[model samples]
Target: MSTQQPAGGRFQTFSAFYPYYVHEHSNRTCRRIHVVGTALVIVIFITALVTRNGWWLLGMPLVGYGFAWVGHFFFEKNRPATFKYPLWSLMGDWRLFFETVSGRRRF
Candidate 1:
């Protein structure tokens, strides 16, 4: 498959990009790490809101991306689609997390 675009020249919509996103996260460990990171990000966001301290917000990306990057580098041994498709990749992360939690997808 070509990495230049999502199945074609470009992904016209998130639905179009989703399959590619899932494909990039084929590694089970990578998917689990992403799920964990996303959950932590959600918790941090809530903490930031509850404490009314914006500083906690700063760690959101760090926590999320840190786990994800480690999974990609060490487990998946592949580059994250985030570099090429930031918005879609972020959306995919949440979608995958929910799917896993709902038992629609394996963790």
Candidate 2:
């Protein structure tokens, strides 16, 4: 899916980027992997805080991005939006995660 840009040729707001983000995750497996990756990231974060394990903190990106990359490369068959829109992409991931878990969106 193409990113619909405004006159500036960029998404000026997250609301704009979100639709493109959703389009990018059209593959069911990709969305599922993203949800799982985000969940694991949250769990890892809590573990790191509870156990004072800085090493676990370091594993967050590895686990999260690894699963996401697998989904993207093998399933989604497209480059991740993260490479271009890092902050918004992360926000999209968490939003999609909560939406899926809360029944607002499908798994």
How many steric clashes between backbone atoms does each model show? 0, 0
Error of 1 at 16 (Å): 1.5
User: Tens digits of per-residue lDDT for model 1 on 1-107?
Assistant: 33345444668888778887888888999999999999999999999999999999999999999999999999999899899889889999999999999999998
Scored by lDDT, the top model is 2
Model 2 stretches with alpha carbons more than 4 Å out = 1-8
TM-score of each candidate structure, all chains considered together: 0.90, 0.91
In candidate 2, how many clashes are counted?
Answer: 0
Please, what is the whole-model Cα lDDT of each candidate in the order they appear? Answer: 0.90, 0.91
lDDT (Cα, 0-100) at 21 in candidate 2: 92
